[model samples]
Target chain A: MIRYSRRAVLKASAAFAGASTFAIPSIVHGESDRIRVGHLTPLTGFLGALGTYATLGMKLAVEEINQAGGIMGRQLDVMSEDSVNPATAATKAQRMLEQDGATVLLGEINSASALTVMQVAARNKKLFMQTGARSDALRGKNCNKYTFHTDIPNTVMVNAVGQSLLRDNMVKDKKFYTLTADYIFGHDLLAAAKRFFGANQGNLIGDELIATDVTDFSPYLLKIRQAKPDVVCSNLAGNQVTTLIKQYSEFGLPYPIVGFNLNTADAWAAGDGNLSGTWPTVWYHTLDVPASKAFVAGFLKKYGKPPENHAWIEYVAFKMMAQAMTDTKSTDTDKLIAYFEKETEFDILKARKAHFRAWDHQLMQEAYPFTVRPKGQANDQWDFIALGTAVPKAGEPLEQLAPTQEQNPCSL
Target chain B: MQFGFLLEQVVNGLVLGGYYLLISLGLSLIFSVGGIVNLAHGAFYALGAYGCVEITKYLGFGPAVVLSPIAVALLGILFERFILRRFYTADPILSLLVTFGLAMVAEQAIRIVWGAAPLSASIPPAFRGSVFLGDFLFSRYRLLILAVVAAVLLGVWLLLHKTSFGCVVRAGIQKPDMVAALGIRLQPYMTSIVMLGVGMAALGGAFFAPITIVHPAMGAEIITVAFVVVVIGGLGSFWGVVIAALLVGVVRGITIHFAPAAGEASIYVLMFLVLLVRPRGLLGERIEKFE
Candidate 1:
C-alpha cells in the first residue's frame, strides 16, 4: 500500500503545478524560434466555405515554404482557427499576439471580422496580412500602418465589372436596382457601386439592404419585379450571394443580373445553368498564367479539387509574407512593414506582378470580370466561369482599376 | 401602386409561410408526443437537403425529393430507437443536451461527407421562371412548393383528426399514463411520431434545397426558425404551429417591405411580441406531461 502525508502531497502538487507553469514559457520560446503566424478565417457561417478553401491554400503555401527550408532557415509555425465573428476575431487576434507569441497575423474573408483583427494587429504593433477581405473602407479611412490588404478592394471589383458593362453599353442611362448585404463589406461595396453609378451616369432606381443571414429572397424578388429595373446588381457577400443567384434564376426576371463582387466558390455554388451576367473576381483557377496553372495542378493533386479564389489569394499572401521576411531577414514588424511599403512587386500567379500601394497598403493587382460559360461548354464543375482578360488592359497601369489617392481617404 | 406592391408581398409571404409550416409542424408533433425538444430536428432537415442533392445526381429532382424524405424517415426510426427513446421520460434538459450534441455530430458528419462547399441545385427548367396572375408575379417553382405544402398539410391534418392512429397519439400526448393503463403501448406510437416529425423536416429541406444554399450548417440555420414557429404557435397545438409559421412568414415579408435591414430580425420580434401577448402561445393546448 502506498501512503503519503497531507503536507507531502501538497508539496508534490505545488511542484507539479510549478513545473507546468515553467514549461509553458519554454514551449512558447521554442515556438518563437520559428516565425509564428496566427491565421484566422471564418470556418463556420456564411463565409465558412470560402474560409475552408483559404485555410487549405494557406496550408499548401506553408508546406511548400517549409519544404524549401522555411523562411530564413527557421520553420514557419501557423496557428489557424475560426474567426467566428468580429468580436471573437478581435479576441483571438489579441490572444495570438499577446499569449501565443505570434509575431504576425493573417487570414480573414469577412471584411467586418478583418477590420476587428486589423485593429488588434495595430494595437499590438504586429503585421497583419489582410488576405481575402475586400471592403474599401479597410484600405481607405480605416487603413493602418500595421495591416496590408492583398485582395482587390470594392472599388477595383466595381471597376473590373463596370468596364465590361460600359463596353457592352449596359451602364449608361440604365435603371439599376441593387440588393446590398447588410454588413461592413456589403455597405462598402454598395458605396463603391454608387460611386461608379454616379460617375458613369447610371440611374439608381431602387436598392434594398439585405441582412446577412437571409436565406429567402422571395419578398425581395417581388419588390424587384415591382421596381422593374433595367439591370439588377448584387452587392451581397458570401453564401448570401449564392442564395440570391439561385433564387434570382428561379424567378427568371427579365432584367439581367450583375454583381460588383463574386467569389469563384460562391459562383460555383450557384451551380452551372443558374448563374448569368457578369461578376468580378480576384483570381480564378483557370487563369492562363503559368504559375497559376502550376498552383492549380498542385492543389488538384493534393485535394482532388480546384482551389477557389480565396485559396489562391491566401497562397500568394503567405508567399508574399515569406518573400518580405526573406528580403529583410527579420520578423521585426517595422522592417516587414517597411519592406512591403517600399512597393516590392510580387508574382501573385498573375500575368503582371502585384505590389502594395505605399500610402494605402492596398495591393495594386489586376482584377477580372467573368461570366458563366455557355451550357455544355464547361469541361468540369469548376470550369464554369469564363474569365475575362485582365482589367487595365496590357498597356494600362494596374493602379488604373484601383482607387486613386483623392478617392481613397487613407493617409498612412 | 404602393398598395399593389404590398399586396404582392402579402401573397408571397403566405407561400413562404407554407414552407415554414412543413418543418415546424413536425417539430411540434415530436415535442408534443415524446416530451423531447428534438434540437436535432434541423439536422434531419440538413440531411434531407444533402440526401436530396446526392439523390438528384442519380435519380433526378422529382424522384430525389420523394426518396430523400423517405430515407430520412428511416433514419428517424434509428434515432428514436437508440437515442430519443431513452430521453422521452427523462429530464427535458438531458434530452435537449443529447439532441443538441447529436445536431453537432450530424453537422460534422455531413461536412465530412459533402465537403464544406455548398452543392448547387437548381430548379428544373420546366418549372423555372415567373407566372403573372393579374398584378402579382409569382415564381413558378414556389407555386409548385405551395401546392405540395398544401397537400401535405391536408394529409397531416386528416391523419391527426380523422384516424385511429391519431386518436391514440393524441391520447398518448395528453396522458401516457392513461394510455398505458388502457393497455396501449406508447413506444411504437412515439417512434411513429418521431419518424413523421423528422420526415416532414427532411421534406422541407428537399424542397428548399434548390432555392437555398445547400450547405452543412443549413440545418442549424433552419432549427432556430422552426423553434420560433413552434414556440410562437404554442408547443402542442397543430393549428397553433400552422398559424404561427404563416404569421412569421407574413410578418417577415411585411417587415422587409418596410425595413429591409430588419428582415431577418423581424421573425424574432414577432415571436417576442406573440409570447408577450400569449404566454401559452396563440393556440397552444396544455399537455399534462409538459406541465
Candidate 2:
C-alpha cells in the first residue's frame, strides 16, 4: 500500500471542503435570473392533508404567474417542501433565506410552525406571506414587521361561529365542555373561545387539553358525557378535529358539537353523515363570487377536486405576492413590506377585496361560518357543507370581527 | 360518582387495549420466530386500512375488513421470501435499517396512490352509537373490535399451542441449530409467522380506520405504540403481550381521566417502569438467539 504525507492529506481534504463550498452556491444560485420564493407547510403530521392542498394551490399560482409573464418578468422559482414541525420549519426558513437565496417566504397551516417561520423571517429581514395559519397570537403578541398573515385568526373564527350560535340562541346560559388541542394554536383558540363565552352567558363547565397524537377520543368522549354540558366545542386542529368528530359521532353524544376552528379539508375528511353543527372557514370553493367560481372551476379541471380553504389561501397569497413584486418592481423585502403596509387591496376571490391591516399585518377579509348540509342533499363528496353568508355583511368594515389594537399586543 | 366515572374509563381502556393487542401480537410473534424487528410492520398496518377503504367502495365494510388483511398477508409472503429471509442470520442493525427504509418507501407509496389527503371512512350505521352496560357507556364499534381481538387472540393461541406446525416453529425459536440438525428447515415456519404477524397488524389498521384518521403517516403513528406494547409484553411471550396491551390501554385511559395531557405519555412511562423492574419485559422468556 502507498501512503501519503500527513501534510498532503490535510491539504487535499482542505481543498475538497473548500471546493464543496464553492460548488454548492453555484448550483443553488445557478439561476440568477429567476426570483426564488420559499414555500413551506406541514406535508406530514396531522396538518399534512391540508398542507398538500396548500402546495397544490401554490403550484397553480406559480404556473399562472409564469404564464402571465411572471413577477416583473423574472420567472418565480418557488422551492416548496414539508415544514414537518415548528423547529424544522424555523431551520428550513433560515436555510431558504440564507442558502437557497429565496427573496420571500410563504405557506404554513400550523400556527406554531408559522410563528417559528415568522421569527426566522424577522431574523433574516425577509418577507414571509403566512398563508394558512390562523392563530391570533401570530398576529397579536407574536406579530413581526417581516410577516404578513393571510388567513383569519382564531378570534375571527370564534366570532364567525359565535355569531351563528348567538343567532340560534345557543350561547346564552349554555354549559359548554371543550376539547382543546394541546399546542400554541389550540391554546390561543381556547382563549378566544373562553373570551367569547365570558362575553356571552355561556358557562365553560369543563375543558380537556388533548395531546396532538392522541387518536382515541373515547376517553375524552366519556368525560364529556359525564359533564352533561349543553354544547361541546372543539378547539382541536388538523386531523385531530376529524378524529374527534368521527368518534364524537360514534359515541352519539346528545350535546351538539360546534368548533372555533375547522379547516375545509378536516371537515371533508369527517365524511358526510358523521359531521354536524357549525364551524368557521376562511374560504370555501362554493363561494358565489365570479373570481371565486373561476378559481374553483380551474382547480376542479386540473386537480379533479374542489380546492380546500388552505389551497385557496395559498393561491391568493402567491398571487398577492406576485402583484406586490410587480407593483414595486423589486423582490426586496423592505420594499414589499412597505407596499403591503400601504394597505393596497387585492382581489382574494372573495365578495370584497382584502388588504393587510397596516398595524398588525393581519389580512382584513371576510370569514364564513358553515354548517353541514342535510344528508343526501350534497351533490358530491366535496359539496357536503353549506356556506353561510360572509361575516360583517356587505356594508360593515371587514375588520369588524378581528381583534382591535387594544386587545392585540402587536406593535409593528 | 367519581369512582363510577373512573370505572367507565377503565372499562373503556380495556376495550382500547383489545385493539392494541391486535397490533402488538403480530409484532411479538415475528420477533419471536425470526429475531428480525420488522420496522416496516406499521406499513402493512397502513396498507390494511387503505385496502379496507378501497374495497369498502365495492364490497361494503363487512367484506372489506376481512379481505384487506388477507390481501396484506399475501404481500407478507413476498416480504418474508425476499427481504426478511436474507436478514435472519445477518446483523440485526441491517434488518432494522432495511425495514426502516421500507417503512418510509411504503408511506410515500401510499401518499402517491391515495394522495396526501386522508381518505374518509365511517362506521357502519349498525355499529354506530354507544351501549350502556349498567351506567358505563361503551362505543358499539369498540365492542365489536373487542370481540374480533378476542377471537383472533384465541385462534392464534390455539394455532401456536396445539398444532404440529407451531411445534416446529417453537422448536425453531428455541434451537435453530438443533432444528437444522434434525433436518427441519425453519424457512416455511418463518414465512407463516411473518404472514400472521403482518396480517394481525393489517387487521388492526382495518378496524381502526373508521375511528382514526386514515392518513399515510398513520402507520408511522401506530408503530411506536405497537412497539411499546411488544416491549412491555417482553420478547417471545404471547400472554405477556396481551396483558401488557390491556394494561397499557387501562393505564392510558386512567391517565386521561386524571391528567388528560399525559394520556399519550402514560404508556411510555408504563414501559419505562416495567423495563426498570424487569428488563426482559413482563412475561418475556429467554431465547438462545436474542441472548
**Top candidate (TM-score):** 2
Q: Model 1: how large is the Cα RMSD against the reference? A: 4.2
Q: What share of the true interface contacts does each candidate keep?
A: 0.82, 0.80
Poorest 10 consecutive residues of model 2 chain A by lDDT?
Answer: A21-30
Q: For each candidate, C-alpha RMSD in Å?
A: 4.2, 3.1
TM-score, chain B only, every model? 0.98, 0.99
Docking class of 1: medium
In TM-score terms, candidate 2 sits at: 0.97
lDDT (C-alpha, whole model) for all candidates: 0.92, 0.93
Distance from true position, residue A331, model 2, in Å? 1.8
Q: Candidate 1 on A1-412: residue-level lDDT in tens?
A: 2346899989999999999667767778766568899999999999999999999999999999999999999999999999999999999999889988999999999999999999999999999999999999999999999999999999999999999999999989999999998889999999999999999999999999988778999999888888889999999999999999999999889899999988888889997799999999988999999999999999999999999999999999999999999999999999999999899999999999999999999999888999889999999988989999999888899899888888888987
| 10 residues in a row with least lDDT, candidate 2 chain B | B166-175
lDDT (10s digit) by residue, model 2, range A26-140: 8675797999999999999999999999999998999999999987779999999999999999999998889888999999989989999999999989999998898899999
Question: Candidate 2 — which residues are off by over 4 angstroms?
Answer: A1-24
Tens digit of per-residue lDDT, candidate 1, span B34-84 = 888989999999999999999999999999999999999999999999999
